[model samples]
Target: MEFHHLFSFYLTIITLTTISLFHSSKAVNPIILPIFKDTTKPQYYTTFLLGTPSLSVSLAIDLSSPWSWFTCNLVGFNDTWYSGVPNSSTYRVQRCTDDNSCAVYDSNYCYTCNSPNCKPKGNMCTGEIYPPSLYTGGSFYGGHLLAPLLLDIITVYKSNGPIPLGKRVYGFSFGCTGVDDLKGLSRYTKGVLSLARKDSNSFHGFITKAFKIPNKFALCLPSASKSTLNGAMYFGGGPYKLPPSKLDLSQFFVKTALVVNPIDVGETYGKRNSSIEYFVNIKSILVDDTPLKINSSLLVIDKNGLGGTKINPIYPYTTLHTNIYNALVDAFTTKAATMNITRVGQVSSFSACFSSKNMVGTKTGPKVPIISLKLDGRNEDIWRFYGFNSMIKVSNDVRCLAIVDGGLSVKASIVIGGKQMEDSLVEFDLESSKLRVMSSLLRFGTSCSQFRGA
Candidate 1:
């Protein structure tokens, strides 16, 4: 008994008991032992009794080899002892015979319990573990009124009708006088002018005053001597001057020597009948080369050459009437065109005269033009101008007289077969009661000149 001898004796006893128990159990059930024999040892006492005779101990102990154990533990082990290892830390395992090298097992294996978490080789893990909702596709991220000014212009253009050549004439005059001041006004003025040039149906208002050619004049009177006719004569035309008080150099101009013509007349009380006519000979300066056709409605003024050099009284009155008449005409024409009606007939001769009065009386005059119209397939159709009190009546069957006041109001009465059939104010204010007087004066064969002075 020494301690070393005792320890060896105990180990020998344990091994002998284990062998005996294994041998005894072999008769009932084969007991396989996991052990490897040293091939270098001699046969008798030198050979280690590593396993049973019929059982292959090497197979069970294969995994115990240094190389095998190292691979098993390094790759990933199922044993619970490695569960506490931190994913961030590395662990070293024993080397195996197959590859006598120690390997490190990182958190990857620890997270997956070291099973197949350790891939020997092949295939890769890609993509985020937790992706955003729209990660698969790109993130989605919304649209203003372009050309606001242009849009405004279009809106105004759509709402209104074409401008008249006469207005262009006035515009040119104004532009010329204050060429330096009216620089930017061209944009809007040009837009208005474009309509006049492009559209054929545009109309303008004109003023007329009655002048009687003397009855004593001979038929061969010379053109220069025509002024000698002492009879009262009506001369109406315009390149009406704008009142200096209300004139805005940026907004308006004047035209000189515009011409007005007599188309017809309406009866007054007993003997007076107002004259009606279209204003022709309006001189429009060429600004944009837009074409203008004859019979196009126009606004004209007498341009009587009154008022101070810098200030004109007749201009403002004429301008006010023209603006109202123009607006009214446009409204009616546009509405009629929209309705597909072809003819917007003659303006009410009476109302035209009244409107003229209002124009001279106030700055904000009537803005609607009264027109008399005869549509196809219809006779005696009277329509109130869309934006004005003016009425247009058709009378192809009989001669009709239309009269317009100096301010632009109109009155029309029909005379058929030498008998005045209908007398009416082709235009009238809502509050006016004088239309009744005009109605009574319409009699057959009534002379239009008798009522012209009204």
Candidate 2:
């Protein structure tokens, strides 16, 4: 498929609103990325400028995994079609020996001298590594780092002006894959921006420190049916500052605490903390006002720190435990029976579906029950998904519940996916240890026009 450049503007320094009191204005703005969906694949793509004379390349937005890389010719990946190297004087590699940041060095697919068939000829640094990540619902990534981690001037364009890495631009370390054992980078995209935690020098880490903002980021993904490939992601709170309008932007937000990982497990990410993933504690789930009768213990974080539900963008549909799924299906089907919404043959794997002929052509469908999530033991802090989002029209005549069952893996209980998050601004606040969900009603324009200060 052809890639299109959706956003084109220079970045500028904006007064940091969410930073500590000591620091003031910083070169910060939400690097707005134009989102494009792959009709065939259940994924979305965005573009970013990687080097000095900025080479624009498409990147898949993945939150479950970390470690982002692009194919490099020097690493022996010449056969692959990679967005060529950023020919700039400022570009350099972060050597393992010279730097002591182990957080940046560790990866499951890390290529060291000890790795099989990877014998370093001489004094080559073994620090440069790439970790293989296995997604629960998508492609299983397995690959090695061909060369040392690279650091260069990564530029992001915004409305105010070009917010280049001013004087503090030491560049960030990214992977350069040389080996070809895993699926090709082209299969996904030119590269991936694994939005999960990495070292202090990684993309999101660097931005948090550089701008002196809380270690948090937010994304507003539009509905799938919307024709325009429009969405917004903010590194800091810079882009979330909507201009004065009639709508109270703050009214849309629902706040909750992060599930506490076991003390022994730690938040080290790639290592023992793999089980942490992006799991969030679910206090309860309610259909309309009535709560579902599933075991609440299923939401507790396990010893491996892998309990509760993960609000993962990688999975297109929300998944629930078999017990919880059955409860939901029964509740929904019972509700449908009262509304006279005839059950059609199953669409996809979702068991609860209605005949499309009755409601597909019409703008309205049977009343969909409101689904609400009570977060982190807070009864009032609820994130609700309306009827329109809970049911999706797969074919012209078949409308199915967007949620699916996780089969028998009771441990992998729930995964709140993209469909539930559409038209909502979801924030992963690492510093505050909270997750905030903002309804789409706060969005003022199609492309965050007000966020650009337009």
Task: Work out candidate 1's RMSD over C-alphas.
Answer: 51.7
Instruction: Please give the CA lDDT of all the candidate structures.
Output: 0.17, 0.54
TM-score, predicted candidate 2 vs. hidden true structure: 0.75
Q: Over the stretch 43-153, how does candidate 1's per-residue lDDT look in tens digits? A: 000001111111100111110001111111211222222232212122222122221111121001111123444322222111001011111111211000000000000
Top candidate on TM-score is 2
What is the alpha-carbon lDDT of model 2 when measured against the actual structure?
0.54
Backbone Cα, N, C clashes tallied per candidate: 70, 10
lDDT of 2 by residue, 1-454 (tens): 2323323222112211112111113424443444444444455555555565545555656664445565544322221223433455466644443224434455323223334333221122232233333344332232334444556665543334423232334555566554352332324355555676444434567666655656777776645423233455666642244434434354567888766455212223334434334567788888876788998877776765545777766567788878888998887777666666678778667788876454422222235666788887556788877655588878876788888887765445787877777656687878777788865433344222123211
Compared to the true structure, candidate 1 yields what TM-score? Answer: 0.14
RMSD of each candidate relative to the true structure: 51.7, 6.4
